[model samples]
Target: MSLPVLTHCPYCSLQCGMTVAARAEDDGGGWEVEGANFPTNRGGLCEKGRSSAELLAHPDRLTTPLVRDSRREPFREATWDEALDRVATALRDTQQRYGADAAGLFGGGGMTNEKAYQAGKFVRVALRSASIDYNGRFCMSSAAAAATKAFGVDRGMPFPLADIARADTVLLVGSNPGDTMPPAMRWFAAGRERGATHLVVDPRYTASAAAADVHLQPVPGTDLALANGLLHLAIKHRLVDTAYVAERTTGWDAVRRAMRQYWPDRVERITGVPVRVMERAVRLLAESRATMILSGRGAEQHAHGSDTALAWINLALALGLPGRPYSGWATMTGQGNGQGGREHGQKADQLPGYRMLADPAARAHVAAVWGVDPDELPRPGVSAYEMLDRLGTDGGVRALMVMASNVVVSAPRADHVRERLGALDLLVVSDLFLSETAALADVVLPCTQWAEEEGTMTNVEGRVLRRRRAVEAPDGVRSDLDVLADLAGRLGRGQYFSADPQTVFDELRRASAGGKADYAGISWARIEAERGVFWPCPDEDHPGTPRMFRGAGEGAERSSTRGYFATPDGRARFHVVHHREPAETPDGEYPYRLTTGRSRAHYQSGTQTRRTKALLDAEPEPVVEIHPDLAARLGVADGADVLLRSRRGRARMRARLASTIRADTVFAPFHWAGEQTINALTNPALDPASRMPEFKVCAVDITAAPAGEDTTA
Candidate 1:
């Protein structure tokens, strides 16, 4: 028997490096996954990670291309050639009839590096449509924008998990990396379980919070205020890393003057965090021998998201966090290679290698890399919300082709966005399941799953790992890369593009070279030999960076080799914000705040997990987590049924009386659909800066489920 191939987990971003055993199938295909050693996960597997085998071969795997006659009609299968012809015919004909802006493409960072690169190429060259975007809008686009504005770079770490292991403290904000990024957790418990302080500030007491030295439960939508208050205490206590601020960064004085407005004493009203808690938070970080302030989606999903990140990053700056071994504000990007994807222009306003699509110099550089004229790259487009908002209107998009994203169940203003999408001339979703996005498609093309295909995935930590092919996709399904390439050729262009993922990947590496996040150094050959490599690999001789910028020892003036915070403000920002009620507050009619999140048994929307009988059985029915206090007030008990409604719509589900949330809020996982779905009540109000719908905060009213429903066993 052949030994297991070394591969990365297809699960979340901890990107656990695993060794998978495999055997050839009668048809010359194979399957693989961790039944062996992995640095991060050891000999363990989460339900989602281990279920990759089942998920890869599900009965429902889309093996053929399909198209519908209209929005309400059922899809009928068609030949790939016929499907590609139709898509291309529509694309080209629409381009000629409506202009480049008439058609749009939405990409996803979840795709392999090759797929992402080729997807962009397909749109920018093959389709020639000016409108293009990806799910990064919800993931980390704001962090990318804000980090680039400050440090000229934003990634999990210039260093590795070991660095966090070596640090004396890690201040986790708006993140649950311990749960989401399990490998990162190795460092979470690194501090003698006590030597270093671990602080988690989130509205919900997430899995990561269970391990923290202190869990600060601030109200939802008030992170910026808490951040500012901490910075206020840092400055007032004279913990400012003055030397590091002046030399490494640019905008400190203005920031300091601004922070002065948020003194801990004054922020209590706006943030709902007491001054005492804010003061303690300051002292903990300020006094630590080493510290790293980690930021995540919670901080970036607010209307003042950019400002909130600045506040958190600014706090790190005040404490002289950047450029140090332990101290820096690193935004935790969730998708595999999400960091690399943005660096390669997967974002709406960027070019390859962290270059700005709007900057002439950067655009020109990328144009040269792609061998296309600068004009061919098109102008910067709108954010995801704008694209969806403008669908079907004058000068708006006529078609939207989505790759691997489930928008109908996921996107904010969930109801309205779907309504607008239903009006489009064409909606094509390429995926493995009948996702909400695919459900609304005029064409749903089944694509290969990770195990059934080979490519690379960049983890949350910036580690570029190989995704060696393990199994053959079920018959009838094709790789998305092949689908797009086939479509491109049938449309009268892109004849040179190959259906081979490796060939597509080579082009991606070429396109990714020479920018701020150069990956020119990486070759499939190198990754195969080394297993993985952290990016910024600019040459063949270089070993990848494991940990990022390091700082000087305690009580030492910052040494030159440590990384520096290069904020234009020279200091971190302090945004003192007042608590504004959520977009849709519960009224006498709607009485509970509805919040959505992941279930331990599933990941985003359960697209993969639900396919696994083990996991599906584990969570067969959807239930809403209601605070016991609230449950009592509503005259409901455990296992009772409830009807939840909002201004937008409503859903019915079994009520779970639990203390998992604040008494004022309820928890619903976004995995289930139909009546049990919680998104129906969610408010789609987006963060003004990030344009992220507030998935964390919303208002809904709950009443007992009607008589026929099982309110009791």
Candidate 2:
């Protein structure tokens, strides 16, 4: 019998540990997977993780390069060299015809750390293009922006997941770990054992809300109001930690003045969360010495997402929650490597190591690592949605390369995005399958899957874990690294790029040496020995920092004068914020608020999960979740088809009677494509601070499907 290779799951930020071994010839020809003991998952694997191996040998697995000369033509099998040459020629032509920014690269949060780093380097160095951004902008950019402004740094969860078990109370705002990341729920279960209560604030009674001690169902896009109300009550009830706020934070007075307007009554009127429920939430938070406030995409995917997140952070700061053991304000990162993806320059405005692209020093440091002049690096590019909107337009991206993202299905206002993509001069996509976005590509390069490649990924808690190769990739398929190297060679920049994962990671360490997300101390060997390592580890002997801004060294004694924050003056900032309406509000024509989220059985865009038989069987199609009262008003029956119309586009989905949802709102999972894709109806209003689109709420109208309307579209 072959020994099992220890590795992590390929889906979500949990990155649960698992083992894979080749099945005996007599048993089967594929690999068998089993959960392995790990701190994040604690030997638990979700349904998606368990069935991930199914993708390895699935029929949809792309094993060869495909290409076409025009959008109207069908894809034809081509050699790797032919495909690389075509992409290289197109990129060069686009840049030469227009400007360097004419070619854009769209990346995914699911990519490995090495691939993410390479993608950034490839665009800035080889193509010399400033047009590069990733899908992570849609995931948690608002939380990242808000946290960086208030706390000097953003590390998803500043503390470890185990800390949740030790907390006296956990306030989850706009996060649903129960369905999004099930393995991490064990920590909550552990907290329950210790009598720690959970408070969930969401528009719907989600799976996580069902398990919580309190559920605050506020109006969509009103998370800012709800958080402000809690802080107002905390101050009104004399529960503010005055000493901590006075000593450890700055700009609180302005925030305090701002909160004055958010009295319980006004907040209740704005958010539709009863005044009593607001008071109960405040009491629970104030009474607990150890409390955690965590936000997620539901809170951050808005036109004012940064302010919404800042409000939650202000509430936590007012209550003295951050920088303490078993307590802090954090955001739940959604994608598998969303935390690392942005840190390593996949983000539009960031250089490697979370450094600002506009900073000359950051540009110089990264340029030195790449053996290039600092001036050679291009300035920051546009955000993801803006880039997509500008495709093929004059003075915009004429050619686009997509890696691991299905933008046609995932981007907000996707139907328009599809049209823009169709207008592109050249579209190149690298993936494991022909996703909805890839189906329109002019060239498609087959890349290795997670279990078939070895690399690193930063998990939800910012711990970097290793993904080991369990089996060889099928013939004719190649890793993204190899494809990038070949393309760079074709572009006459091969010497600057390496196809090996370890070499790329070592280079990443050097480039990130002194930046905010320092990984100088983390070596591949050390990661293998320690299972995983948190970031900001500065030296070889230093233990990876599991927590941040706590006087540097582990458990080091600190003086009162030294504040515990990453801000310039060592004190966390408090931004004065106010609640605002979503970009699109429910109106007489569109009388319902539409919100979108994830399905327990599927991951982003449903590219890989939809191909797996087990997951597809579990969540066969997207469904519109509506309150029974609203369904009855619309004369819609459970399991009956419903036509949902929005200003952008329309989609048809089954009407599911969910009493847990608000009557004024409807919910849909954005895991499928075609007319069933809820993103088609989502608004693309961008946050000024984070450039994140408002995917959480939009105006929509619903009615029973007209007779003979095809649900298949």
Candidate 3:
């Protein structure tokens, strides 16, 4: 037997380290998983991580490519050459018929940095298409936008996860790490044991909230007001760090004036949190010597997520948090490679190294590396939702190539996304499983799974970890790199892509050098030797940056002082924002507010996790969590079937009555597909700044299912 290969989990951004040992031919051709003593998880793994290897041997795992003659026909097994030729020909023909913008490329956050970089380059150079975007736009775009506007850089967590354990207090806003990222809870547990206090702010008393020293359950979509209220109290109580604000930040006067309207009583009326609770929450953060403020999708999936995040950042600035040890603002990225995916080029408006596509210097630098003319590179395209919305319309995206994403089950207002996808002339998807989106494709390319692939992923803490291939993939299956190379070769652009991960990664390093997310110093060998390496490691002798903004002045190793910001003036800017109602709200027709989130056992779309027997058994199906009072009023009992009707669509699932959620709201997980797809009822109204759909808040009404009705539908 061979020794286990060290790797990271293929789940959330936690990227918990694990070792996978391949089984013998007689014992089943998969792998066994065990935890590794990495900094993030510290030898601990979540349920999804432990059972992730099961996907390698899943019976339904796609091992061969599937293709169809037309949209009216069923899929049939096809040769690799046939599939590649078909895809290339469709893309070329689409571009010839329509413009280059008509051939769109959609990527996933789960893709490694190497694949993401190559994919972006392939679309721009090979297809010469400007319409490219990924699912990360839906994950943390608002936080990313806010961070760039404030700090001029957009690393998800400016400080390492270890800082959480060293803080005196942590104010978790709109996040439930206990369920989404179980291994992350250990940091908070250690902090609590060391006399640190945790304050959770969420409408539902989530698992993270239940363990907090104080839980501020506010009304949904009012987090911005709540944050302003906290800042107002901190200022009134004489807790403002005047020196820090005056020296390190700009635009505080405008913010101070804006906080006047969010007094405790007015904030209480808006957020539904008691004035006393808001005051206590503010004091806990202000009095602490060091505090860390963290937020997740709950604060970033609304119509005003950018403003909401800015409000939180303003509160942190008021308490003098940024640039201090164990004190700063961060966002918990949800996907496995979300941090790196956006930084590289999967985003619509970015080139390699987190550089803007519209910048001439950035385009020239990357174009030189790719050996392409700077003028040949296309301009930035529409965002994820906008690109999806334009599909099949006149002069819109006619052909789409999807990589590693299940948009039908994951995108907001998925019913409309499904319709738009159906209207496409050509739909191509590459995935390990036949997801709901793949089921509607003209061609489905089977790709290698995590254990059977070698690549790199950046974690939530900005640490880039390596994933090594532990088991041989099934015969006839190919890596996404191989697929891309084959398609490029078919399109007469073979020199740009390589099937080898190391070669691709070396090229990615060269492409990312001297840019915001510089990784020229990091390599596979260094990662294997050091466990992981953070970015901004610009040279061979330079040490990796674990914490950002560490330096006190100019010319320092990691400067946080004035004149260091990426802005024109080199100072952090603050935005003054006020609360606004969500795009959709409860009304007479749809009287209950509906919110969606992830469950502990299942990841997004449930494509891979649903195939695992152990994970499926844990959370077999979707259920709408409703407050007991609302359930009683609707004449529904626990486990009773209910039909949730929104203005967009309807979903049928079992009711789970609980007091943890608010009486006027309902919660449902967005992992299932078909009639149980909760995203079908979600609001797709995009945030003006981030273009993120409001998945957290929508209006819906619930009614008990009729007798003999199929609740699963």
Scored by TM-score, the top model is 2
Q: Arrange candidates, best TM-score first.
A: 2, 3, 1
C-alpha lDDT score of every prediction, in listed order: 0.71, 0.91, 0.90
RMSD of each: 3.8, 1.6, 1.7
Give the alpha carbon lDDT tens digit for every residue of 615-690 in model 3: 9999999899999999999999999989998988888899999999999999999999888999989998999999
Superposed model 2: Cα runs more than 4 Å off: 551-562, 710-713
Give the winner by TM-score: 1 or 3: 3
What's the TM-score of every candidate structure? Answer: 0.91, 0.98, 0.98
**lDDT for model 2:** 0.91
RMSD in angstroms, candidate 1?
3.8
Per-residue lDDT of candidate 1, residues 1-713 (tens digit):
36666676666666666665554676455444664455555565665666666666567777888898776779898987777677777777777877887788887767888787777667776776668777777678667666666665666555565567667878888888755665567666776465777888876778888888777877676787788778777888899988876756666777677777776666887666677777787888988888888888776765557667777777886788776665667877776657656566656676666667788887676667666787877787777777887887778788788887777666666667778888788888899988877888888888887767888877776777788775657788888888878887876666646788777667666666666566777888898777678776766776765454433453323211224322333333333333355566667777667766666677665677777788787777778888889999998888988888777777788888877567877877877665666676676666675566667667778888776763212
